[model samples]
Target: MRLRLRRFRPRTGPHEHRVVQPLHPLRHASLRDPDPIGHLLADHDGLNRLAGLFSFAAYSRHTVVHIPLRDGVPPDEGMGELVDLVLVHHSYGLRPSQWPGLRRRLTHGTPLTVRTDEARTARDAAAWQARAHRADRRDELRHTTHARTFFLFGSRDVFAEAADSFAYAAGNGPLHKRVQQGDLALVSAIPGLRQPPGGGHPFEVLICFKPYPPYAHFKRPGR
Candidate 1:
């Protein structure tokens, strides 16, 4: 039998990258911690205040967040909040099902873990030019390194302060829908960021708050 080589599909395009799925068995096991969502709700008073402001229209770093009508706020009133959690680096959309996993990790103060395929290698600059479409993607395949990072957010003002420089995976659909429904929306920051800068060794951490299905397939890094 003749073997056919499978074509590589880049993680791009509007709907192509949207792989929102449920937690894998192993990831589900990690969520055994006691009521993590409740803990977060109890902890952040600032989050509680601005939790209602979730819907926004973004262009570049500028976003106009619309406050819901529940607080008797004017329907025409659009509150401005900065967004820093745009999932640009990776193209996959955020999965609502993974919220529990994220909650578990946050409650335990554990960094989100990711395992990439070791077989795939990063394309060189010349190679990247050949595949010009993936211009936003960083890191070489062979150089895939593990990152230990946690999520962070303060007041809704902070969220409204900076136009997030990152991109979101869900394009602009469910992300807006979930927030409108009053679902818990959050952004995770790279780990060790809370400490003063220049205090720890320099490490590159990804910013996009994309929670993938447990054990998602990754191409082995190429040499």
Candidate 2:
């Protein structure tokens, strides 16, 4: 995710509501793997090399690992081989309904990350549908308290840029103001750095980079 940081310039209407916070990854370049992951997934939250957070529910089977980018880089800072499994957060994997076609394209063993338990509940589904504007079943990935995402990247530049933009804008200052208020637009593949499309109308550009896992993501001590 690479975002060129810019303040959202209001282009229409009066009573412009400006968000005084750094909206992070919006309108940023994304680096999708450009391929689909078939059912080869074993661990739902497979680790990746970047830098971010991970959580264990204290008493649950699910653990969430966040691999956020700071800003867009030169386009090859974080490129990895296309893995057999994809950790789909927010539809990060091929859609289940569309999985058969995806299976045909890639190797078998891919699995989608249905991030939430509420994905099974109708009440949560309805509310999620009302609040989201994503692909058909993206909300299913928000099952846990953490709404992190995972996607195959095309280039490292996108990741590097996202990191740079977010780091510059997220601090408590002018940029953070608009960001916190939500009067800004974001559009980044990394989510934390997303700025809305054509968001120059009242929404400020609070560029921010989402975090990724450390370079030694799977370097759990001893192994």
| The best candidate in terms of lDDT | 2
Candidate 1 local lDDT, 161-221, one digit each (tens): 2122121212221243233333323343222122234655433323222122221331112
- Candidate 1 ranges with C-alpha deviation above 4 Å: 1-153, 161-193, 202-205, 208-223
Instruction: Estimate candidate 1's RMSD in Å.
Output: 20.8
Q: Best-fitting candidate, measured by TM-score?
A: 2
Q: 197, model 1: CA deviation in Å?
A: 5.1
Global CA lDDT of candidate 2, please?
0.24
* C-alpha TM-score for every candidate: 0.18, 0.20
The C-alpha stretches of model 2 lying farther than 4 A from their native spots are: 1-152, 172-223
Give the Cα lDDT of each candidate: 0.22, 0.24
